[model samples]
Target: MTKNFNIWFKNFHAGIVLKVDVLIPTKDPSKIRPRLLQVLKGSDWVGEIIIETSKPLSRARVIGARKCSTEWIAMFDDDVEIPENWFDSILPFIQLKDILAISTPSIDVNNVHMIAYKRVMDHFRPLEQRDAPFIDNTLIKREVLLNYNPSPLFYSEDELLYRYIKKHGKWIHPPSCGVKHFLVMKDLVKAAIIMEQLGFYPLYKFLRSRVAYFTISILAIGYSHTYKTMTFFWKSNIKLMAGFLKARVNKKGII
Candidate 1:
């Protein structure tokens, strides 16, 4: 959470008109509170920090939304870092009348192929099928959230919200505004597993439609095994490779 606060402050300070609310929902408040306090010590933009225990991600978001005092709220994951002038580029879009939500671009720091894969996959998804990019990194109006209740059962709540907004209001993604995503190779494998477990099997199949991700995952695993000789790293790489392989076997069209 402190990590997110630092990144948000560094990349998103404007001419004092903008106010920010940083909401953190974690299962262990005791472990995170001290660190959060240290991070929030001198911040001016932050309005509130909401902490919850043992709640699912979607429910945590709803809890955070209820605590927000401002008209606009920006959701973000704890690990992401917004590049400089990120807010400057997207400020106009946020200020637009009738816009319910705005999503900026996200770039991967490691495994550049992952970023390419998302663009290719997202581009191909039907507008109705596509969700707002990353929920944590997107900006939303309080009114939109007030009107809609997020379902904890959905695998991708961000997409669910985006689809709802598209149905009832306006949703936009600007070309210039984006975040730099730092994804360790291990995190990528864990993400694949979580997605599959959460019912994002369709995305897994779509990304694995060609030999590109498959070959990359395999070669990445092989290289890690042969050169590093670290069992943990090797295993993580293998896990990602297995995910791609599983996708090949499933081969179902996108849901």
Candidate 2:
């Protein structure tokens, strides 16, 4: 698979002059990190693969933008498994002048909680047309990305970049561009907590309403495969809401 990817990469990038770098910002070591590195190294289209484990995701991205020697950078999470032909799928758009950045939905159906979560997220920001781009599987131009400072929280950081990109230039979500994101219940809860802490309004604006949110939550619980998983999903949502409410009461400003 790796050899095929290299051959494909060389064939495609041979005509294109732009160099693409990859930056992975992770707070702690992850189980999937090794596989992720292996996959990235396999691609000849990718120039430098910089993994920064020291800073928060937002700061790490800034570091990557500064450190990268290429014109474009693909920012991704450590947990994401790049799909085969991922570069080939998006290379056409990269060749376009107006399309400054590109993003796609992360597909993962292994966990029931993940299914429910993705459903809600898809509802809000459909892959067909996104108001802002997601960072997990996105290709961004270094010039546009170097302008601002993103929030420390992962979700909010993505939100900040989305808005910034919208203000700067064109961003797109091509149907062909997609990646598999391995999500766990623990990480989901942690992300939700961070969203609330950083003033969840960034993502909240994309949501339909509180009513829709809870309705989908109930439907997700109903569709769970096992009682244990259902219980975990329920409790996690509760804790997430609690954190949001607490942040609201404390008068945290939403960026």
Candidate 2 lDDT over residue span 57-127, tens digit each: 67788877887877778888878887767776776666555666887777764577656755665656665
Q: Give the TM-score comparing model 1 with the true structure, all chains together.
A: 0.57
TM for candidate 2 is 0.75
lDDT of 2: 0.66
Q: Report the C-alpha lDDT of model 1 over 73-112, residue by residue, as the tens digit.
A: 7665554555545555555665455677776666665554
Q: What is the lDDT of residue 238 in candidate 1?
A: 62
Against the true structure, what is each candidate's TM-score? 0.57, 0.75
Counting only residues 3 or more apart in sequence or on different chains, how many pairs clash (N, Cα, C under 3 Å) in candidate 2? 0
Poorest lDDT segment (10 consecutive residues) of candidate 2: 204-213
Best by lDDT: 2
Which candidate number maximizes TM-score?
A: 2
